[model samples]
Each structure stands twice: as C-alpha cells, then as structure tokens.
Target: MNTRCLVVCLAICAGPTFAQHIDIDPRKDVANLTGEQIYTQVCQGCHMPDAKGAVGAGRYPPLAGDVKLASGAYPAVMVMNGRGNMPAFGPMFTDAQIADVINYVRTHFGNAYTDSLEPDDVKVFRPPPPSNPPEKH
Candidate 1:
C-alpha cells in the first residue's frame, strides 16, 4: 500500500508495455507498392526489382513477368491463390495492397500487361479453391 511499493509494482507489471509500438506508415496505394519507395520496402526484397522470383521454395513468383497473369484467370485470383509457395495475401493485404502489388507486377519485369487493376475488381474476384476428393462409399 506504500507509494514506493505501488510505483515499483506498477513498473514491474508494465514491463515491455512501454516498448510495444504499432506505428506504421499509412498505406499510399490500394494494391501492392510498385514505385521504388514501396517496392524496396515490401516487394523488392522477395520479388527483386525486375520481378524475377527467387530460386527457393516459398520464393515469390516473377509477378507480371509470368504469362499466367495475362490469361483470363484474372489478377484477383492470383492475389488470392498465391501460386507455387507464396502465402495467400488475401488475409494480409487490404484491397489497395492487392491492387498496388498487382499493378506493380503487371508493369515491371519487362512485362507488357498494362492494365491497371481497381480495388473493386480485386475485392470481387476470389479464385476458387481446389476441390476435395470424393469419399469412398
């Protein structure tokens, strides 16, 4: 009940609380960041500035440089499915993040797919998951 004990107890209990800070730069784009700023911060590390994927498992694919994106499957599905070993960004990225990344990929890596994806498009089109096998009778 003493003031010194109370202060010491509060400090002990609040240890690590003071160190936690969740500050993050506000997102500037809805889709993945493509410019040097956002790219270097989030995409360039795994995807290389040229959009070339890495050589290991879980290595991200070469964004729009790959032909799979141009096909009718739609960019939204790709963002959601995350082929090879890339984790599904749907849960992690906002609609804008999805759009920005998709936009960056489509234009980078010497790729020619020039369509700018809208957040609404990404929001609506989720790729279908693989079907489950039938159960034995």
Candidate 2:
C-alpha cells in the first residue's frame, strides 16, 4: 500500500480513539482554570487558537473584531443556548468559566469590547431548571 493510503487509514482509525479519550463529564475541576485555558481546551477546537473562526460546510464566524461582542450578554447567550453549529457549553462549564471565556474572547483576538461579564451575568441567560410536577395522589 502507498504511504498516503496508510496515513489516511491511520487517521481514520485514530479519530474515534482520540474522541473516546476526551472527558465528557463537565463537572471536572474546571473552576480554577483560566479563561484562556478553558478556551484552549474547549472553544479553540472550532473558534481556532486565534479566535478567528472557520468555514467549511458552514461559517464559524470570526470572534476577532466581531461587533456582537459589544455586549457581554450576547456571547454569554450564545455560549449558553448555542447558535447554529456551536454547541451549548452551559452544562459543560461553570458560570465563572463561561464568563471567563466570554471575557477572554471579547478582549483578545483584536476584539476591542471592554465590557466585562460576571458569573451572575451568565446565570441570567440560563434556562430555569424544569420544575417537578406534584406527585399524583
């Protein structure tokens, strides 16, 4: 077999194995990590290290110089509720983590937005937990 074919086979085989190694649980020790750390581990996969998003079958929308960051609430909502292909990090990250990443993205990557987001700010966007119905008599 040619080297190209062998490389392709190896890459395909590695995909699932690489994904399987990821920790799916969101409740890990993420609180102490910085926003840059959180973004590197989570958002950077799609948003890119530069935070200048990508496009394939879809546009990831560059976070750098994005006017949407003008309001801290906007990105917080997106992180929580998700938009388009971006998955919601609401369950995966603590409120502080969400705020950190939001603040990080807003301030870095050539973005000039100065507004800061606190965990309390993010909490506003989170959907209320479903209420349990009264037990049937």
> TM per model?
0.55, 0.78
Task: Give the clash total for candidate 1.
Answer: 9
The digit string of per-residue lDDT tens for model 1 on 75-111 reads 6686666655443556546676677766766676776
Q: Which stretches of candidate 1 lie over 4 Å from their true place?
A: 1-38, 57-59, 71-73, 126-137
lDDT of each: 0.55, 0.73
The most accurate candidate by lDDT is: 2
Summing lDDT over every window of 10 consecutive residues in candidate 2, give the lowest-scoring window. Answer: 1-10
For model 2, how does the per-residue alpha-carbon lDDT over 1-137 read when each residue is reduced to its tens digit? 22332332333335544333443222333446688887776677677778788776556778989998999999999989888777676876679989998999888999877778999999999999999999999
How does model 1 fare in lDDT? 0.55
Against the correct fold, how does model 1 do in TM-score? Answer: 0.55
